[model samples]
Target: MREKLQHVAGRVWLYPHDPDPEAIGACVGVIADDRGSVLIDAGNSPAHAREVQQAIAAEGLPAPRWLVYTHHHWDHTWGAAAWPDVEVVAHSSAVDLLTAEAERPWSHQYLRDQVALDPKLGPSFRARALAVPDFGELAIVLPHRTFDDALTLPTGVELRHVGGSHAPDSIVALDPGSSVLLVGDCYYPPPFHLRTDDDGPDLAMARRLLAEKHAVSVDAHSAPRSGS
Candidate 1:
């Protein structure tokens, strides 16, 4: 019900914390420039995506030049196809993971189960999803271009692959102009049930890198964290 877009610095904008009921997924970030804007992550549903799009336009910015995904989770990728025409960009494995999930029974069940489990989301998200009945329509638009490692935008935005905790395919976008690093679902607090493929070394390594980085860093669905 209550959604906020926080201007961390320069041109970086983050929505309410990713875990918020209204968000229903990770946080949303917007990176804008004179040429065009870039969406850090798509929301979880059509309604969610619409809100994100509206928020951007409300800011008087044009449609995003690219919709860069942090990972392939349903909360991040499901609403992608709902977005206005923009090139989707992601790690090759992210697209593969998206395609693979489309074929899984559990993927569809996540909706039904979440409604039964998460009280806040049930009324707003599940009820609406039930009204539609065609769960398959949520099929996302796949990334047109794939990259193995880092990809630099023509506009000079740099996205670096950062190891993740919630999922295997996490990456961070570096906006030099904004002096911000967007760590999408890459850092999670403790006592969490979500499991990651990474063991001790890689996850620890990622943490070290994040700590050493000097730019202000924000999680996929969080407020701006100080660079220190």
Candidate 2:
């Protein structure tokens, strides 16, 4: 239901902010270059994915020919099925995780597990999941394509493996063509939302280390465009 796109820098735009208020998903990124548009991360769910797909169409940009998964987090990876046509790209490690997760069907017990993960936020998350008409519905599509530590796409987007930030398979995409580096969830996520546990993605505290490391790496990666 929300229709908004943020042109952050150059042709770099953000369908920023998670449509689901309680979802851990972060803002989605889009890079519209001479080659074509590239989506940084998918939204939180099938519906969320469709919403962003429509939002991209509303922007008058060409459908994203490519999708780069910054990491394997659910909020970013689950919606990938929405764009079965795009050339999906992700880190090799992420490929393993995504493939493995697809075999596991989501159930109401998943909510109970979340509650067990964080006593503070668990009940609320469980309630939200229950509220969704089809919360138990689960599906995931592995990337038709993949990469190792780094890759360069035709759109002039540079994806370098910058894990040890959020997820071990995390990557920071540098788009000299767009003058924006799509770091995915590598940037600081909301502090309170950091729930690093045996079951969660990356530990929230680990993000600080990721930020520190990615800051140096991205700056080096963007020096020419930034004139630094």
**lDDT per model, in order?**
0.69, 0.65
TM-score of 2: 0.74
Task: Report the C-alpha lDDT of model 2 over 1-228, residue by residue, as the tens digit.
Answer: 455776666777777564354555456778886567888887667676787788878889778889888888777766777675788888888878887877764666776676687777563455346333475444676777778867888878888886764467878787674456666656433223454443443455435434443222221111212222
Per-residue lDDT value at 67 in model 1: 87
List, in order, the clash count of every candidate structure. Answer: 3, 1
Per-residue lDDT of candidate 1, residues 1-228 (tens digit): 236567878888876554544434667788887777888888776667777777777777667888889887666776687777778888877877788877755334676676577554454455345323456666667788778789998768787776455566778788887788887766553212232344333467457656766578876655677875
Candidate 1 accuracy as TM-score:
0.78
Candidate 2: what lDDT?
A: 0.65
Worst 10 residues of 1 by lDDT: 189-198
Which residue pairs does candidate 1 place in steric collision?
A: 18-27, 18-221, 27-221
Give all candidate RMSDs, comma-separated: 4.9, 6.1
